[model samples]
Target chain A: SAVISQKPSRDICQRGTSLTIQCQVDSQVTMMFWYRQQPGQSLTLIATANQGSEATYESGFVIDKFPISRPNLTFSTLTVSNMSPEDSSIYLCSVTGGSEAFFGQGTRLTVV
Target chain B: AQSVSQHNHHVILSEAASLELGCNYSYGGTVNLFWYVQYPGQHLQLLLKYFSGDPLVKGIKGFEAEFIKSKFSFNLRKPSVQWSDTAEYFCAVKPGGSYIPTFGRGTSLIVHP
Candidate 1:
């Protein structure tokens, strides 16, 4: 399993602000997945980032609202733009290790 | 569209009680199944996985799961439960050759000591 590190473990931001969460994996991975877990809700995939290409957003996610950047194989960043209270959730980054997926310590965001 | 379903939303059990959390996936072809557990204040960890061979697969911490192809079910089971087993369990599935996995709404298990 790859060791994943996420920065800004917890944060509080006001409405209309933007916050960027960073994920770094010890080893290079082919696919990096971003997921959101609302309070008491299931994990919903936000996007899939592959190095050197544009990120693919899920059904309800968009490029403008949740922009992603994967500059290298081991690093990816997800930015929540124009945040609102509804955007408050735990954001997690995951990578496929063999057939299993390993996740990072999630970023808990609270929008006021 | 592929989807994973976990029938139990919340389960309460006493120590040494048997556990069986039901999970079902909607897919026609070969699929990879997994069970992940998230302890309080911790990240999700893989409990067990069933890809091929041996419908019954055992994982860390004495946990296991059986994959029933005809029933389209991959249910997690444990002969006995402990306080440490109290956590949220999620079932995920990925169709063969697919990189993305669909996760079910987790089942929260609470075990009394």
Candidate 2:
């Protein structure tokens, strides 16, 4: 089992501002995933963060808008840049090794 | 593309009522199934998972799920529910040979005391 500690449980930001959310895991992992859950919707994968290489983003998500940084195996940060009202959602950090996946408490971002 | 479908979006039940949440996947080959629960102000927690073994798998909090390969369904069931069981439940499906899993839209279960 893995435990994740995510920062900024909730944040209210203004438009055009950026908010970086941090995720720290109790153990080192090979892959870290970032997800966004809009109201009344399921989780949407934003990107996959690896320790050495650059983050692999999914379709409809760009690095400039959602830049990810994985400095080490146990830590990663995702920045929501140039926030808009549409960007207001819950962002979660997840790590999977075997069959089960562990998720962070999630960061609730509200852009005004 | 593989996807998971959850039939119920919202459900309201009285205390001690039976509960069932439907989950279906698009994959035909081997797959891994899971059910997760998220209470208010909490993270997603695994309720149960089915890798391979008995079709009937029991999970935490007396929740159980049956994996039917022919129908491609893994539905969650609980005979009796309490008010504390009110939360959002999500079903996830990980296709064979894939590490990442696809999540359903989720079902909000509201148990009335």
Candidate 3:
């Protein structure tokens, strides 16, 4: 299993402000993914961050609202732009190794 | 599109009681199944996974799951429950050769002491 860490474990921000969450992995990985978990709900895939290229976002999500950047194989960042109250959720980063996948501690963002 | 469904949303059980949580996927082709647990205030942890070969797979903390291909079901079970087992359980499925997993809504299990 890989040791994954995310910066800003928990943050409270005013509406209209943006926050970038950072994910760092202990080892290099090919694919890194971002997911959002609403309060009392299942996780929704936000996008797949590819190193040196634009990320592939899922349906119901767009890059303009949730921009992602992967500078290298072991690090990625997700910026929630123009945040609102509805944007408050737990953001998690994941990477796959072998047959299993591992997740970071997750960043809990609350937009007031 | 691949999707997973967990029948129970919340389950309450007393200590030493048996536990079962149903999970079904909407894929007819080959798939990999997994069960994950999330304790309060912690990240999700893998319980067990089934890729191939064994239909009945055992996992940590006296937990096990059986994969019934025809029914597209992989249900988690434990003979006895403990208060420490009170947490959220999530079922996930990945297609034949896909690395991405689709997760279920998750089931909240509460074991009364």
- Candidate achieving higher DockQ, 2 or 3: 2
Q: Looking at model 1, what is the TM-score of chain A?
A: 0.99
Error of 3 at B70 (Å): 1.2
Worst window of 10 by summed lDDT in candidate 3 chain B: B36-45
Docking class of 2: high
Q: Candidate 2 on B50-87: residue-level lDDT in tens?
A: 99989999999999999999999999999999999999
In order, the TM-score of chain B in each prediction is 0.98, 0.98, 0.98
Candidate 3 lDDT: 0.93
In terms of TM-score, how similar is model 1 to the real structure?
Answer: 0.97
Model 3, B63-98: lDDT tens digits are: 999999999999999999999999999999999888
Please tell me how candidate 3 rates in CAPRI terms. Answer: medium
Candidate 2 residue pairs that clash: none
C-alpha DockQ of every model: 0.78, 0.84, 0.68
Candidate 3 chain A worst ten-residue window by lDDT: A36-45
Which order, best to worst by DockQ? 2, 1, 3
